[model samples]
Target: METESFEDKGGWVIDQQSFVVMNSSYIMAHGMGRPVKDAATTVKFPKTGKYHLWVRTKDWAPFPKGPGKFQVLVDGKSVGQTFGESGSDTWKWYDGGLVDIRNANIKLALKDLTGFNGRCDALLFTDDLKFTPPNELEALTAFRRKLLNLTDKPQEAGRYDLVVVGGGIAGTCAAISAARMGLTVALIQDRPVLGGNNSSEIRVHLMGDVDKNHYPKLGRIVREMDNGDPGNGNPDAKEYGDARKISIVKAEKNISLFLNTHVFKVEKENDIITAVVGRDIATNQERRFSGSFFSDCTGDGTVGFLAGAEFRMGRESKAETGESLAADQSDDFTLGTSNLWASVDRDTVSSFPETPWAMQFSDEYHIDEPKSDWQWETGFGNFNTITQAEQIRDHNLRAIYGNWSYLKKNKAAKYGKKELAWVAYIGGKRESRRIIGDYVLNQMDIQEGKFYPDGSVTATWTIDLHFPDAKNSKYFEGQEFFAGTKHIKVAPYTIPYRCLYSKNIQNLFMAGRNISTTHVAFGSTRVMRTCGMMGEVVGFASYIAAKYKTSPRGVYKDHLAELTGILKGETLAPQP
Candidate 1:
């Protein structure tokens, strides 16, 4: 293959979708209104010749005319072809006709026509259209390696004692804790930064109590990492503190941090996961990370999914989990994702576009203008947070825009002078795909205050379950974008270590909301800081696993005493 492909760099904001062209994909000029700045990437052509430029893009919504549309620029000149508006559900390379490039240096830019998410996976220039690479994952992976001249083995990025798959509060603490224990660690995050939901992109302030009773060291790192307020962001004029989390991760010298890399596939040996395959979001370069143990901090239990681990999604029946909070009968409806937005009181009156595509809300569900925060959430109606994440986020965006538009068009005093200061396309998800472990924590464990020998990570938040807003669900029917929560108070209780690792997959451990908790119990344990504590416990357990050459279950079965000491701060290595 004489064609060389280039991945879109930082100019485009990422839009997360599971089972996409790559595990990671980008959206140009997302969440903002029509503007002029171009999302550009510089590429050096290997040979000077006339070649057909084909862009791999998708029409996210499978309508006649797609929601997103963009133009490709060659050497600052428009290619005259509007991409994304024409492709189907499957991402295929669209021919931008023929283009002549005499010089090696060529600048490719994405000029957006619609503010809707215009996605671009890769751009490949080839002389022959019939000889291009296949779009299937396996074939595509091999072709990418060959085109980039990458090794067949995926090129070992690093071998560590521990590899944490998610970079949320939990994954960060997991990596930090393991690094402090004199273990080499790798922290891989799909997004550009750490702190996952708490990161400014999502802007969910760290929740759950820090420096709690069961274990002080449990949330010690979280206390340090927790910056800004509880809602979306610094509600005041001040900016959100994302740099603090990055600073903490960078300060840990014993860890190799891979940001903007998504781990989509796993290499397993029987029940043990030997390695994980990750692709860089920016460069599209594939790397294999080898480790003694791996943590599925990737909130949807992504690592566990690829490794074929036994996992449960959505709620359990009242009879199954034996919790009153459980549904009458179990189905696939889990806690929905929160897509939050904030508006500032402008000095002058501002206007917003009418959101025709958004779901309609009744008077009861109608949001008051200039007053949106964590309360403005969506995605409980028939939407799967994993497969349908893009739709879920877009649905939220439409609701937010429509609400603002109604208020502005109607000339309401509440939002007459208000302007949308910030709106996030990145959805802050709560629950999905809980990897099955030895212990499936139920509400009875927390409410009954049942103590286990391997208890770790205290639960603080109530059994908060989110449902579709009654009025909104009635109006929108199957596509409700408004949600409401049901909370059940409970005394703080500890989560057992057995709930942290996969029951079938031996080397795989889990943290965050995906830990082995019954749906009802997860309602309380799903907060950011509480998830961090789970990560801390798993991190200590990983060290013990590496130290004793034990499996995750082995750490619990044989070394629970040592693991208890670590959680209690006795075995914690002094923080750097």
Candidate 2:
């Protein structure tokens, strides 16, 4: 049985951030240093007899024996051996010996011993002792499908005029804008909620000014969904407004919002996209959405990458971009991902166990804080944010837990009553793949306030680039958990409409941090409000494309005036 499909998850959380690399979403017992509640489910055997048990898990930190140790309980009885201590850094199956079944239906549970982030992918039971589960990702996926009785064909989820494959602030506004213009839209989000980083799961507040845009009404949809700013890493989940974002989307009659759906496959003809396929995270069911135009608002450029769009992942060299902020020699260095955490003060003193497997902290080395902010980040340099996402999040958890443990032990006077309130399992990512478009905006464009005939969205944030904190590097060199930034202020500048749609992929449009821009220019335009305005511009462009029966490039090259006029509050009716 899949551990993530447990009937009662208890204190475990579903982690699907690295599903592309790991093949399946797994449940993690992230109880800081304490053991979490048991994850239990009931299963029926086809035949009551002796069966061999196997569990798919990993020893995330194998040094000095894995700290994330757990055991399987059948009817509240131990299954003999402890799992997650296999000494293998990668995911593998652990043998749980043989068990005699007296009843057809029985209760099964996973009991975590030391919750330093114990994880389980799936469990298998078979009467054949020689039958071993596949260890490879591809083979494992096929095996899972066969066992779960899932079909190879995906269910068709009707046709649409526009399909937005993300539900962040940018995608949310894009769907709303298009729906209001009479275009049938499908807004797909991987998580259960609408907001991506700003959602309650991540707790990052919205930034940038919507009222200061080139077109005053460009960010109207964004303002409609705005929850009050509660600052970054706030412990109050309601302050982030997960419900408000969903309610706004549900009110749009022309939009079909699919939450907990992750798009992984793209259907294309020649250079244009025809349909996108997504799988439900909980049900493991797939659906295909066919659309005339598509938007890649996924911050990682996930849909764009799957559609084979031209993209870049790292910084550009000074010689290549000719930007003053560009690095002397470019490498694979991009902004890191953050996993913010918070602790609350209780009336009575609280106790936290020691974490030897976690990163050890000293009085001088610890962060010495109750809550984390934007500065607490990881995954820079050689760490591939897409593939090594799980490792990066685990590293952040270690930092938070280790530091808290140190504070509880060494600095008890101030932190004795403090207890971990919330820890973000979903890593709040900043940068990844930037889909290339008709024009790549550079730093000079913003600095000189260059006039492009198709300037649509206004960007007001500074050219802020983050690096490993100098003090943090002294304690943890390569795996620094803290971040620092140098903000170069710039005048509010307009972003060209040409930078919103893909250059080669005919029907693709992009927004958010994944828009076509150099690393230096992206620093200023990556904020949410700027991204929302880009979505507004793309929505107008989509209407022009549909009315004129043209592509995104045609809208820019031949009908730029019409698109600009629509953005300036001129009314245009949708074609029947």
Candidate 3:
């Protein structure tokens, strides 16, 4: 049985961030070092007898011992051995010995031993002791489907003029802009909410200026959904405007918004994408969406990657990109992800338990702030923002909890009344796979204010690159959680439309941080409002492509003038 499908989740939260790498969404016990309440469910056995149980879990921190230890309870009885104490880092099945089942209907529960981000993917009970579950993701997926009676074929979701994957600020703007221009659009989001980092789940306020670009009306749609500058990692949930964003998308009659739907498969012919397949996060039911054109706004370039689009993940060498800001040598050193958190002052003093399993912090070396903001970040250098996402998030959580514990213990007088009000589980990612395009935007293009004829979206943010703070490194070393940034100011430069569509994939368009930009140029273009404008350009380009029956490249080569006119507030077609 899938642990995520438990009747009562209790304190365990559904984490789908690493679903791409892990293959399935798992439940995490994020009780801040305290043991979380049991996640209980009822299951029926085929026959009443002795059964061997296998639990799919991982040792998140497998150094000395796994901190994420948990037990599987059958009818409120322990399943012999601890599940997450296998000492292996990868996700594997741990033998839970055997349990005698007297009744067909029995109570099953996951008892979290220590709340240091313990996770459970699924569980299996077999009458045959010799049988073992598949460890490989592909084989395991087939095994799960056959066991659960899930169909291999996906249900049709309907055809669209444009299919926009990811419901972040960029994807939202893309769908809204296309819908306003009379395109039947499908906007798919993996999360329950519309906004990504800007959503209440992450609470990062929107950055970059809107409506200050060459194209005056380019950011109008983005401005309509703007939640104002609430600041990063704000404790107030209402400040980020989740309802406003969803309502605006729902108001568009031409757009079909799919929330909690994660697109994982892509169907292509020759070099053009034909359809994309997604699975519902809760039900695991797959749906297929066909479109004339597709947009990869998934920040990680998920759709593009599946469609065989050429992409880059690490920073380019200075010799290769001819940018001074580029790294000395091309390496896997992309910007990190942030899991921001905050604390609140309470009327009564609150006590926090010491987290011995977490990263130990002393009075001399600890973040002495009441809350976390952008500075509290992780996943840099060797750490991959995609494959190692869960580890990065857990590392950030360790830092937050460990630092809070230190503050509470050392400076009781100052922090005794403070309580952790909010902590973001969904990571605010900065850099990942950058889908290659016709013209790659570089650092010199932004710094020297270089102009292209097809300049569509104006980027106003600075070339802000983050690195591990020297002070933080002194304490945490290679596992540093804190970050420092150097913002290099630049004149507002228009990003070329050539950077918006894929070079190899015929009909693929991109926006957000995953746009065709060097690691250095992404420092400026990664902000939400700038990405929103990129989406606007993609939307207009999609209209031109649909109208003229051309590819994204065809729009640039032939219908450039028409796309520019549409961007400049000249309505090409009436809203349907």
Cα lDDT listed for each candidate: 0.77, 0.88, 0.90
lDDT of model 3 at position 397: 80
Every model's Cα RMSD, please? 3.2, 1.6, 1.7
Tens-place lDDT per residue, model 2, 1-576, is 988888999888888888888767888898877789999999998989899999999988766666889889998999898988777878888888999888999999999998678899999999999999999889988898899787867899999999998999899888888888889899999999988998999999888888876676588877887887899999999999999899888988899999988898899998999999998876677899999999999999998899899999898999999998999988888889999999998999998988787789986778889999999999777488888898888888888888888999999999999898889989999999999999999999988877688898878889989999999999899989899998888887889998999999999998899999998898998988788878877777887788787999999999998887777777666522
Q: Quick one: best TM-score, which candidate?
A: 2
**TM-scores for every predicted model:** 0.90, 0.97, 0.96
Top-down lDDT ranking: 3, 2, 1
lDDT of 1 by residue, 1-576 (tens): 111123443335655455443544655556444443567767788888888887778776544555567888888898888887773756666778888887898888887776666677667788784666578777876776676676657768978899999999899989988888888999999887788888877788777876555776677777777775756643442244667778888898998999978887899999899999887765667799998999999899999998999999987899887787788998898777777777778788766655454444445556765655565666563788888887777667767766777767665577778777667767888878999999999988988776788888877788888887787767777767667876788887888999999999999999998989888888888898899888888878998999899999999889898888887778765643
Q: TM-score of the candidate numbered 3?
A: 0.96
lDDT of 3 by residue, 1-576 (tens): 988789899899888898888677889888766788999999999899999899999887765566788889999998778877666778888887888999999999999987777899999999999999999889998898898677867899999999999999999999998998899999999998988989999988899988578887799888987988999988999999999999999999999999989898999999999999998776677899999999999999999999999999998999999999899999999888999988889999887876765789876787789878898889778589988898898788878888888988889899999988788988999999999999999999999888799999988899999999999888888998889999999888999999999999999999999999999999999999899989988998999999999999999999999998988877568878
By TM-score, the better pick of 2 and 3 is 2
lDDT of model 2 at position 390: 89
Question: Which of candidates 1 and 2 reaches a greater lDDT?
Answer: 2
Comparing 1 with 3 on lDDT, the higher-scoring candidate is 3
For model 2 the local lDDT of residue 416 reads 97
TM-score ranking of the models: 2, 3, 1
